[model samples]
Target: MKLSKEMRGFQDRIGHQFARPELLVRALTHASISSPTRSDNQRLEFLGDRVLGLVMATALLEDDKSASEGQLAPRFNAMVRKEACADVAREIDLGEVLKLGRSEMMSGGRRKLALLGDAMEAVIAAVYKDAGFEAAQAMILRLWASRINAVEDDARDAKTSLQELVQAKRQKPPAYELVSRTGPDHQPVFTIVVRLDDGAEAQATAGSKRQAEQAAATALLSKLEQKQ
Candidate 1:
């Protein structure tokens, strides 16, 4: 239950401390760690997922004075997507604070996108439970303010923006082909490839085809940006 000095400083820097340090401990504990006394972050990840959605939804409502549900839904999804959360977690070095078993540690679980992303959500849930929604909202704001601001611009929809970019060059509309699927039918992981007319392609995976298509589109746009 004891945190290193660096971890303590990290909490301080974020302007919140856990009332029950075990909550924070559990938030950062991956399931790969097997010990009678150790708990995994899965449950915390579940709670945190809801907390993160609610926080982001409330923020979007408050910040977008004229946005309808239709306008805000994509923005919300983009903001709370796993990759986005993982990016924020990495920025704060949350991986360094995680407690992993030797197996997980050796296998690079600390850098695993899914685990890091889930831990970020679990941390958000812990903050909300320990302190309150305001604290959690503040934390999200600190991490997402820039992205939120960019969302206000018309170019926020990466998929649609990418489509336009392709069209402007008189190219065919991009096609998304299913590359692979894994996991149970009820919760399938879809891998999709976005093929452009210029013979360029990008692939991404998500929990659903729609999400996978969006991810693939985003990746294609990123590649286009890099080329320019």
Candidate 2:
């Protein structure tokens, strides 16, 4: 089956020339569009997740021969997590090519992090099925080169670092509370407050609760560091 010009352009952007264009189409088809004749990307997402894990595991070990599993584990999580996959999807403009049903489209499904991440994984599985592991690995490594290189940076995300610090000090885990929510349902701003038992606290706002929590943790950590 021939692909539309837009999808072809997307293929070029991702640097994968699909031998089975149908797989690409299927990968872009979301559950919201499921029907008797149409299939969603759920199964493909499952397979692609394993494919991604294998590729990342091998890549991590190759990059550092002496690193322990403890060291590599968090890095692997940072790379393969849903948010990371969603970031890659955004980079490729995968959302634009997604085939969402009317309700999904109405609710901004294209920009949804979960949807984008799942679709990205499905696309990876499609590449693997259409070609082979070699082709899929090549695409993954190429697309994820920057993230792989910056694994250390990801390892130090504010929430994790803050947790470690508090644990070492024999304090209760930092508590995150939703302070407020603003804006429309489609584009909401979340205000999260991160507070320590020692009376230190910080508040931050972002498009998502997770992001807001991270920001709040970062702010409080910085303030604590300044005192020391």
Cα TM-score per model? 0.67, 0.72
lDDT by residue (1-228, candidate 2, tens digit) is 999998999999888999899999999999999899999999999999999999999999998774555456778999999999999999999999999999999999999999999999999999999999999999999999999998968865678989999999999999999999999999999999999888889998888897688778878877989999
Clashes of each: 0, 0
For 1-228, candidate 1 gives per-residue lDDT tens digits of 687797787687666887778788888888887467888889889988898899888888887654545457779888888988888888888999888889888999879898889999999988988998888889888887887887645225667878899889999999989999999989899999999988999998878786677778877877889999
Q: Which stretches of candidate 2 lie over 4 Å from their true place?
A: 156-228
State residue 172's C-alpha deviation in candidate 1, in Å. Answer: 6.8
Consecutive 10-residue window with the lowest summed lDDT within model 1: 150-159
lDDT of model number 2: 0.92
Instruction: Give me the displacement of residue 44 in model 1, in angstroms.
Output: 0.6
lDDT of 1: 0.82
